[model samples]
Target: MAIIKLSVTERRRLSAFFTCLVLAFAAWIITVLSNPKPYVVKEVLEFRNTPQKRAFRPLQSDTVNVTINGTGWDMLFSKMNSAYKAITIDLHTLESKSYVVLSSQKDQINSKRESDQQIIAFNPDTLYFDFSNRKEKRVPVHLISAVRYQRQFFQSGPVTLNPAYVIINGPASVIDKITSWNTDTLKLDSIDESVVTRINMQPVKEGNLSLYPKNIQASIPVDEFTEKVLEIPVRVLNGRNIGEVKIFPQKVKVTFTTSLSRYAEVDEDFFEATADLDLWKKNGYKTLPVVFSKIPDYCHIIKIEPRNIDFIVKE
Candidate 1:
């Protein structure tokens, strides 16, 4: 391959143009090197939950460290000044019975005064909050679901709950306007007895609502119960035994309906209505004494069709 060479005049013009280009580039570099861009050194404000062992308070004062950066003229232009902004700490996200370190730095801070400049490195990357005020509040709890009852014989009573309320407190902005708390949905498919369960409390947010104690203690007592058909065994008590006495229907039959709640306390043999078997035997087979059985204090024999019957003795 043959190399093409520039002519004498062409070479001279090209050389001059090259020299000018190099000089322009060198001038640009010098300008940039001599005057650097301006920057600011503001405090890296980090907040910590003070009373380190105890829970964090809503209001507290935190310390901050500020520094500077960039050219002297840039600093003069910046007019370094302290920055202040409303920082919000949400307590709702914190775990129950837990502590956390939250912080807020100047997200977008520019020096308002001259002679202020940013530093490449910030002073004290973290800040400590001297939290002092401890606050707590009683929050109301509301029920949301209905528990279903079991079979026809079973009955569902009013739902009962222990410590139906909770208390929460935090920053004013986070604690103000908290409405109410609710438990998870309760479903009773086919329960005959009382039911108990531990449910998580859901918080209602009206306005920034914050919770101090994250986990709420819950207790539900389920009553194990079932309906029972207790047969009241009628027995003859405190009556003269007549020899060779004849009685019709040796045992009086009684039927009644009651709650399974009182089933355990019910004693069919205790229910009794006096029947004069001796009187019947002497009266030539007259009306016999009919007795009913005793039942639990809370239960009642709603219906007793036949209170008395004729007594006959077999000879």
Candidate 2:
């Protein structure tokens, strides 16, 4: 390193030069921070005061683009920390089937805004809405969950929903057409056990309809399953029983599959295997298809061996 020395007068001049530069920079920064600027942004509008039985279709946009003016520092701070409320437009006093000008009610809209940012002007400068009464009804909430088992596991019972039904309310014309509401699709790939969770409903934008309960508790019951074979006896009914009739085969081998919980409960008592006498008499066929009646839920019938039995009238 090389050492260099300067006179006291030269050092003072250099220090003063640096001091003036610092002062000038500080003044310029203050001017820029204090100056007010305009920012074009969109503000949300919330509708309120409508009849409980009626729903309005929002024909106009629910947001307005406006020019807001404020100091840069204040604007930046507000942008980071300011929480704005949706501008409310009351439709309680307004009549149905009529157009209400939002520009005329700009003061009412401004009154609802709590932000300190000054809105210079609205971009469209005009707003209107066509309000109408909605139709309402109670409909079933259908839960749709696509689930797959990991292997040898199956749903033991029906998929249950905490809130099975939701109130569907909207325009009368639109509501009349809606019979059922469906929830969001749920998928469980290779599910090995039972699961219970909260799921949200699908938003119905058609006809501006709304569901009272937007979410529900879904439960999918699952259990390990095994194949079960039940040997159900085949009984001849109706015409065959009326006359002296003999069936070539008296018993049938019924094979089925069911969940482990229900494996033992499923026996001959839970189901009925019958050969309808009327069907035999009407068709006059040598063999008739066996009809299994009152099968238990969650029980899957796999194979019915010797599905038909030959019958002959005894002298």
> TM-score for each prediction?
0.29, 0.63
Candidate 1 residue lDDT tens string, 123-196: 34432232333455787766555556554433323445556667765544444555666766655576655556
**Model 2 Cα lDDT, one tens digit per residue, 169-195:** 777777887777888988879888899
What is the TM-score (0 to 1) of candidate 1?
0.29
Cα deviation at 40, candidate 2, in Å, is 15
Question: Candidate 2 — worst ten consecutive residues by lDDT sum?
Answer: 93-102
Q: What is the C-alpha lDDT of each candidate?
A: 0.48, 0.74
